[model samples]
Target: MAKTSKNKRTFKRKLINKYRLVILNEDTFEEKLTFKLTRLNVFIFGSLFSILLIVGTIFFIAFTPVKEYIPGYSSSKLNKKAADLVYKSDSLQQIVNVNTIYINQIKELLTGKIPEVIFDRDSILQTFHVDRDSVNLEPSNQDLEFRQQVEAVDRYSIFSEATKSADVVFFSPVKGTLTDGYDSQKRHYAVDIAVEVNTPVKSVADGTVIFAEWTAQTGHVIIVKHAGGYTSIYKHNTALHKQQGDLVKSGEVIASAGDTGELSTGPHLHFELWNEGYPVNPTNYIDFE
Candidate 1:
């Protein structure tokens, strides 16, 4: 017990013990500086200093840009920029794929390779609502009167005198509301028909395709040369069914409507009629109700 008490006393004494450090001038033997410190105070001060240093380092790394320099650490700005670049690259790749498809279609047209025509019979029947069971044996009064007027005035015929009666028959190109009518003064030669997306565009008359290609202003445009110097133009299509040099029957599916070109506002078809190289109103000849 006595030895233990003595050890405790020595430990306490060491903890509180103080030492005087004096610096003296060598030549004059005069004291220049002196410091009085205890062992306990020195230890406490050193521990506090170490703790402050650690806290400062942690705060600097957490709040300052210097943390980006450390391995495995990334800057938020750089990460965001990388993500944006990846998105842009994906969009560019999609655009390239679309252009490639258009180019291949144009190449097939140039090579005189006609694409196979596929029709959605159900959609067509539903749109037109044609009743296959019913048949009108007798002509209506309106039809009889229209026939008389057509025969008397001959206003419906636009072809040459030799082919006027033969070329008077025309099939409606599409079933839609006419948004814009042909106006000679405004130079709007084509009639705009607004319709649902992927609606099939049909030919106005039996003709041979003379031009089928993509254009910057009109997108996928197809031109057909009919008998009696008549030509029909269909533009702003999503996909073309017939290529150049392909013979198309009246009311045959030629293309699908879409908003493809730069000038397009929505899915629609642009139809234009030309007679002897002069632009003519298509609505005058075909009744697209």
Candidate 2:
């Protein structure tokens, strides 16, 4: 009975040893000991791996350069060049004064009474809203004398008779009553609809929104360029409703009224209409009365 008991104990011991794990020796070609890896060790290794991945990604973005797209950044550069081409550097007021004086002096001495540039005069008055008062000088100084010369040369600016017509309309240019007739006097070529500040303004014609910008003189201004070479200008806006490149229909609300320019006495709309590249009396075109 003692021998049998000892044999049974020996058998159990051998079975236990057979199932024990052995880590094979890498270099010594003998059995090697091993430690059981705990869960904490595995968690630390995973955390370090994740941190390294995130840091590498951040470095790639911060150190590398990239490009961006922005609008109107080049407007200043391009506009300067365009302005130079479109107009002379001299002041329009100075040139007008000098030319006016020169023309009057020459007209007095001429025998033919100086053939009046009637068609040219009509066209110039038609285009820029030039009035006789605009060219008329006070007759006191050298600057005043020069206006006559400017008016004389202005004869060459008549429309080429080939300009195509572009239609126009108005929501409201100003809030005041039509105080003065659109005559050849005040040189107020554009229509003035006088209104208190904060009056809502809208588009007069169906067109593409070409400009919605702020200026030092005009304040918040919007310009819509329509087909047929026609461009409508809305100046002295209190706020703008639409942005550039928006397609707008006639009578669409575009801005609110305000006094924006150096020429403005009160809140008003200095609304100008162009027909095939020329400024015509807006009164002749649209029925805003």
Candidate 3:
């Protein structure tokens, strides 16, 4: 107990012990500056200075742009850019899905894979108990007014004009005997016209050529997109004169007839007419004989 108490007293004396620091002029031996300091005082001032330096460093990193350079830190601008990229990726995925579906539909149209179902309209009307005598043929005042309004709007607006199947004028693609007519029961959606090799095939209507490419099954094939949702396809061609995106007038030459495909039996033109994605008989529109 005595030794411990004596050690504490010595430590306290050393901490409180004062020392004189003096700066002197060498030649004159004159004291220019002096300071009376203790060990405890030096330690307290050094500790306070260290604490202030640490606090200042922390504030500089937290509030300034320097924090972005440090590891494990992200900037607000970087976060925004990352979010934008994520949204763009999602949008691109949706566009890709839509394109895939569209391509599949085009494949079905080209391969004649669309299913055809025939239903009896007379039987359906009888089952529904629809009587022609009970139905009124006259239009009400409101219906007449709406029809007049629609007619007035369609007269001035060319884009709003309704296209009737009868209004379309189809030009004959070639002068040849029809070898095979469109048979939905046999899944034959096109008409095969027998013609000589290298005979020029004309467009049925004014339109833009949408597809012109070679295929294994159809050989050189060309498709035209006409106004009023009309699409025309020509296959088993020797060559396509008008490329894709080319505009063609009615009866303009677009391709040459040939037996170039695996399915071709002889030199002929396989012509197809589609309205709003449904195949229609070419004989109904244009005469090939």
Candidate 4:
């Protein structure tokens, strides 16, 4: 018991004992600085300083933007910016997808490549709430009279002829000798109108230019999409006056003719007319003499 009590007192005295630390100049042994500290005070000061340093480090990392540079650390502002960018990219992708689909449809129209459809006759009739038995099969008196009037008109008359008897009138793109006419079996869907080089080619109808670009087979080609689903194409042009998306009136000069393509034998206008993705004979509506 005495030995234990003596050890405890020794420990306590050691903790409370004061120590003097001095800094001296070695030449003269002159004291420049001194510190009187107890072991307990030194230990307390060290522990408090360590705790303050740790807290300061944590505060700086947590509250300041410097933490973004540290590994395994992220900033809330960066997260928000990343999220915004992701949403913007998603929206832009959607817009691009929609535009691609629209352009594909236009290309299909230009190429006359119609997608096949499963025709459900019953479903179509039911959707329109029509009964086949109740529908009139005979033409009315006015319809017969109109048909007679249409048949009496000359087939080659540009003023009377329209697209399948529709009211739209087509103007001739160019008036010249027809070197070649539309032949579907040979896959020649356009009339090769032999015209002088640099002759002005006009639009067939009031429409908007949908395509105007150089092609390997057609050279400088321009396409116009008109109302009533009619589209006209002019190929082998020296220069185009209108660009894609330009609105044009009927008979407006859109391009100058040239023998520019690999298929061209001489300077002429290769003109094609299409209605609802099917090529139509341009002579049926226009007098390209």
Question: What are the lDDT scores of the predictions, listed in order?
Answer: 0.84, 0.69, 0.87, 0.87
Clashes of 3: 0
Candidate 3 per-residue lDDT over residues 1-289, each given as its tens digit: 9999999999999999999999999999899999999999999999999999999999999999999999999998999999999999987876666666656656776688965334333434345455899899999999999999888783322222123555668999999999999886676888999999999999999999999999999899999999889899999999999899999999999999999989999999999988777777788888998
Pairs in steric clash, model 4: none
**TM-score ranking of the models:** 1, 4, 3, 2
Q: Which tens-of-lDDT digit does each residue in 1-289 have in candidate 1?
A: 9999999999999989999889999999899999998899899999999999999999999999999999999999999999999999987876666666666666776687956444333434354455766866789999999999878984443432222333547788999999999876666778999998889999999999999999988899999999878889998999899999999999899999988888887889999988776777777688889
Task: Give a tens-digit lDDT track for model 2, residues 118-203.
Answer: 43333443454557866856576777668877876864355333244533444444446654444334555567777778887877
Question: Which residue pairs collide in model 1, if any?
Answer: none
Q: After superposition, which runs of candidate 4 have C-alpha atoms over 4 Å from their true positions?
A: 1-163
TM-score of model 4 (CA atoms): 0.44
RMSD of candidate 1 to the truth, in angstroms, is 24.8
lDDT of 4 by residue, 1-289 (tens): 9999999999999999999999999999999999999999999999999999999999998888988999997789888999999999987876666666666666776687967444333434345455889999999999999999999986433322234664578999998999999876677778999999999999999999999999988789999999988899999998999999999999999999999989789999999988877788888788998
lDDT of 2: 0.69
Off by over 4 Å in 1: 1-166
How does model 2 score by TM-score? 0.42
lDDT assessment of candidate 3: 0.87
